[model samples]
Target: MLLHILARGRIARSPEGELLDRYLKRVTWAVKHTELPDRGGNIPPLPAQARTVLLDERGKQFSSEEFAAMLGRWRDDGVREARFVIGAADGHGDVARGEADVLIAFGAMTWPHLMARAMLAEQLWRATAILSGHPYHRAG
Candidate 1:
């Protein structure tokens, strides 16, 4: 399944952007990244079998094992894509959150939009590696 990350804010040529690129490039699955303005920009269209996941403070925090299992289940269920949305500084509105299949949180602490993008990219790589039985994850 395609793993697409749609994030708000310009990552630019910053260190965070470099980290995001490095991790994303290591993922064996199909991956795509879309960068939007900090405020306004339409997200790309998703495939019919796509599932949207919004990254929000109010979202559920999943353990690495659980996260990997979720990805595996979705793939087995024929999900064509899993699109993860990272909102701007103000975060996502209720309407936007409601449209998502899953609301995920890195932690209760708020993170900068750019760092969130990089973190998400790394997590995606980890999740995919875990799914493939790779030793990189070292799940506890």
Candidate 2:
């Protein structure tokens, strides 16, 4: 399955962007990164087998193993793509959250959207690695 990140705001040339790129490079699965303006922009059309995961403050926090398992399950179930959405400054609205197939949180603490975007990329790489039985992910 493809791993796609549809986030708001341009990452630009920065440490966070570099970090995101570094992790993303390690993932074996197909992936994509889409950045939209902070305010308004058109979202890409979702494929029929797509799964939408919204990154929200109120979203559920899962362990690395659990996340990997979820991805594995989706792939096994023939999910073509898993699109992860990171919202703007004010975060995702009620409607968007309600429509998401899954809601995930990095932590309870608030983080800048750009930072969150990078972190999400790293986590996706980690999850995929874990699913492939890589030693990179050391469960606590």
Candidate 3:
């Protein structure tokens, strides 16, 4: 399955962007990153088997192992793209949240969008590594 991150805000040539690139490069699965302006950019078309996951403050928090399992399940079920949406500073609207297949949260604390992007990228790498029997993720 393709792991796609469709996020709001330009990451630019910043540390977060570098971190995102480094982790994403280590991921064995197909990965794509799409950045939109803080507002007004249309989300791209999704595949028929696409699964949308929105990152929100009220979203469910999953352990690294569990997150990997979720991706594994989607891959096994023939999902073509697992699209993770990270909204603007104001966060996602009700419409987006309602339409998402899953709403995920890193924690209760709010993070800058750029930092969140980097964190999400690292988590994606960890999840894929866990799925591929890699020792990078040492789960407790």
Task: Quote each prediction's TM-score.
Answer: 0.96, 0.98, 0.98
Q: List ranges where model 3 is wrong by over 4 Å.
A: none
lDDT of 3 by residue, 1-140 (tens): 99999999899899999999999999999999999989898899888998999999999999999899999999999999999999988999999899999999999999988998899999999999999899998877
Q: What are the per-residue Cα lDDT tens digits for candidate 1 across 44-108?
A: 87789989999999999999888889999999999999999988888899999888999999899
Instruction: Name the candidate, 1 or 2, with the larger TM-score value.
Output: 2
Candidate 3 — which pairs collide?
A: none
Q: Lowest summed lDDT over 10 consecutive residues: which window, candidate 2? A: 131-140
lDDT of each: 0.91, 0.92, 0.93
lDDT of 2 by residue, 1-140 (tens): 89999989899999999988998888899999999998889999999998999999999999988898999999999999999999999999999999999999999999988899889889998999898888988888
- Report the candidate with higher lDDT, 1 versus 2: 2
Q: Model 2, stretches more than 4 Å misplaced? A: none
